[model samples]
Target: MNLNLRNAIIDNVSGNSQDQLEDTIVDAIQNGEEKMLPGLGVLFEVIWQHSSEQDKHEMLQLLEGGLKKQ
Candidate 1:
């Protein structure tokens, strides 16, 4: 069966407040379940798409720092 994970993730979190969204992200990361990665990717994609150039640069810098530690 074909599935649209991006839309599904968005639908599941629809109408969530900022705190709720933060909780969802924190929970997913803390859980570290492989299943959660796609949802997180979708969320990150939304953030990336809407971010300003400077925001994107900072995000990339953070991501680079994160990868260096791994």
Candidate 2:
């Protein structure tokens, strides 16, 4: 079987408003289902691609802090 998961995810989430996107992310995290991970990753990819260097740095810092909390 051939599957294009990334494109599928992008297509699914395309045109979503900020609030709807937030709801999708929050729901996925709160649900904590492994199936939702790829979707989250796709979202992160979109964010990373569009983020400026400073935004990326801030995200890295936040990610580092979250990792430390683990």
Candidate 3:
């Protein structure tokens, strides 16, 4: 993702409440629409970058579990 677009998403999301932001993220992932993928990727990238190693490991584990269920 371009830095400008990433910044734009951060700016746009900054106004949202935590629940709303989570809902938006969950919806995007659940829907799995083509257009939403890039935004989801950006979200994941941003999260992965800032997360602690333990948190990242937990997240990856959760992701693995979710993938296994599918």
Candidate 4:
């Protein structure tokens, strides 16, 4: 058996509008289901790969702040 989760997730969400993407993300977070984490990680990977250095830095800072709040 073989599974390529990242590609599968990407394919599922491909061609979705911005509002649809936001709904998917928000629903995944609100549901707090473990299965959705991989999809979220894949989405984040896409975002991170395309982000500018400044964007990356800001994302890291936001992540750091979120971690500190925990």
RMSD of each: 1.0, 0.7, 2.9, 0.6
- Expressed as tens digits, the lDDT of each residue in 1-70 for candidate 4 is 6989889999999999999999999999999999999999999999999999999999999999999999
TM-score sort, best first = 4, 2, 1, 3
lDDT value, residue 51 of candidate 2: 100
Over the stretch 1-70, how does candidate 3's per-residue lDDT look in tens digits? 3468777777777778989989989999799798887777777888899999999999999999999999
Query: How many clashes show up per model?
Result: 0, 0, 0, 0
Please identify model 1 stretches exceeding 4 Å from their true place. Answer: none
TM-score of each: 0.92, 0.96, 0.71, 0.96
- Give the winner by lDDT: 1 or 3: 1
Candidate 4 global lDDT: 0.98
Model 1: per-residue Cα lDDT over 1-70, one tens digit each: 8988889999999899999999999999999999999999999999999999999999999999999999
Residue 13 deviation, candidate 3, in Å? 0.9
Q: Could you tell me how far off, in angstroms, the CA of residue 53 lies in candidate 2 after the best superposition?
A: 0.5
For model 3, the superposed segments whose C-alpha errors exceed 4 Å read: 1-3
**Which runs of model 4 end up more than 4 angstroms from their true locations?**
none
Worst 10 residues of 3 by lDDT: 1-10
